[model samples]
Target: MIRVVVVDDQAVVRAGFRTILESEPDIQVVGEAADGADAVSVARRCRPDVVLMDVRMPRVDGITATARLAGPAVVDPLTVLVVTTFDLDQYVFAALRSGASGFMLKDVEPEELVTAVRVVAAGEGLVAPGAMRRLIVEFARVGWPRATGPLPDLTARERETWLLVTRGLSNVEIAAELMVSPSTVKTHVGNLLAKLGCRDRVQAVVLAYERGVVRPGLP
Candidate 1:
């Protein structure tokens, strides 16, 4: 079963998510919290596989909570799926930088929510392609300056695979593009993740943008 903890300030929202998630046989709501501070404590106790977090909760806020639970400093990080009513780029960027594995609007369909949780739990990132593009554009617009120096040592093939990943290409698509087998693509992706110190493709995508390795609307 995929254990999950739901955190939101609104009681109704928490109840709704619990109901939707509990309906899935493969998923279980292990705990719930009404604010960010409580979320941290509940998650620590439950050690859930996934956390459905709200961005604007009082006390600590989802971004900080995510950083605490899943940041690079964490030895054993929990997968966080940030669900918020707002589609603002700031929230999305903050959540990603804080080590969230996925971000979704609160209005997302119940089915999509379930899939997102499963995806993140399986060690993948689940941001929509459109949202990712917007995130890159927003970063560019703001001139989000990140330290640009020698990139982590990556082979030429691994660098190509990383660029395709940032472009939102699936493994099969990357394989097709590079004329290689899917297993080969997967190997390259794994190597990229390890070398970049990214938790998943989502983090790698964000890192690519932050490092100016990839830009919005570019080939």
Candidate 2:
């Protein structure tokens, strides 16, 4: 079973998520938290596979909580799915930077929520095509000034792998596109992460955008 922890300030929201998650035999709500602090405490104790977090809470907030629990600073970070009522671009960017595995609007369909949790729990994220577009456009507006110049350290294969990543393709899709094995794609991805100093694919995408390697609206 995929253990899950639901964290929302509202009791109703937590209960609702619990109900939906329990409907799936593969999912079990290991615990629930009404605030970020509780979420962190419960998550560490329960060691759940996935955490459904609310962006705005009375104390700590999901952004800080997520950072504390799943950020690169964590020795062993847990996957965090940020579910927020507000779709503010800042929240999305902050969550992604803080190591959130996925983002979803609170009004997302119950079924989609379940699937998102499952996907993140499986170590795969739900970076939907629409979400990817939003992320690209938002970051494009900000213009990551520090990511200029070619990544001189990247190998030819690593550069190609980065293109696929910035295109929002998964490892499997990248492997197919490059006519290479998934393991090979994974290796390239790892190398790119190390060379670019990115914590994860989300950061890699951000870096690609800032460096002008992948412009917004590119097919």
Candidate 3:
């Protein structure tokens, strides 16, 4: 089963997510937390496959919680799915940068939520929700001020794969785009992720923007 820990300040929200996720035979809600502080402790104890984290919890925000749970320094990190009520919440980007596997708006349909947990659990962060797509368009237009370039030593093909990943394309889509097999795209993605120091696809997407490998008004 795909064990999940639901973390939110609102009791109803936690209950609602638990209900929705547990409805799936492949998913089980193992625990719940009312805030980020409790979330860390509960997650540590439960060691869930997926953490459904709220963005604006008291005591500690989702960004910090995600960093603690899944940052580069973490050993055996857990996958985190940061959820926000607002689509354009800037903190959601921060959570992504902090190593969340992915994110989605809280108001998403129950079916989408279930699929998100399954996708992240399967180690593919991007699903049909398109949260990463919104992040890319928004960041591409606004442009981060910390203009810095210098991607790690990436081969020509690896760089191309990295760019497609930044666009939030899945391995299958990337394979079709590059006219290669899905396995080849997976290899490129794995190699590029190792070079870029990203734990998952979404972090790689964030790194693309932060490194200035991709930017506003530029492809």
Model 2 C-alpha lDDT versus the unseen true structure:
0.83
Q: Candidates' TM-scores?
A: 0.91, 0.80, 0.89
After superposition, candidate 2 runs with Cα above 4 Å error: 145-157, 171-200, 210-212, 215-219
Question: lDDT tens digits, residues 1-219, model 2?
Answer: 999999999999999999999999999999999998999999999999999999988878899999999998899999998887656777776877788987777777889888889878877655554567776676568654445566657778898898888766888999999999999898898878888877667678766766788786565
Off by over 4 Å in 3: 127-129, 140-142, 145-150, 217-219
Q: Tell me, by TM-score, which candidate is best.
A: 1
Clashing pairs in 2: none
Q: Give the clash count for model 1.
A: 0
What does candidate 3's lDDT look like per residue over 1-219, in tens digits? 999999999999999999898888999999999888899999999999999999898999888999899887888899998878755556888887678888878879999889889889988665233665565566667766453666678899998998888777878899999999999999999898888777778877777777777874455
Across 1-219, the per-residue lDDT of candidate 1 in tens digits comes to 999999999999999999999999999999999988999899999999999999998889999999999998999888999998765778878888889998888887899899989989999887766566767777667766475766789999999999988877778989999999999999999999999988799899888877888775566
lDDT comparing candidate 1 with the true structure: 0.88
Instruction: List per-candidate RMSD values in Å.
Output: 1.8, 3.1, 2.2
- Full-model lDDT, candidate 3: 0.83
TM-score of candidate 2 on Cα atoms, chains taken together: 0.80
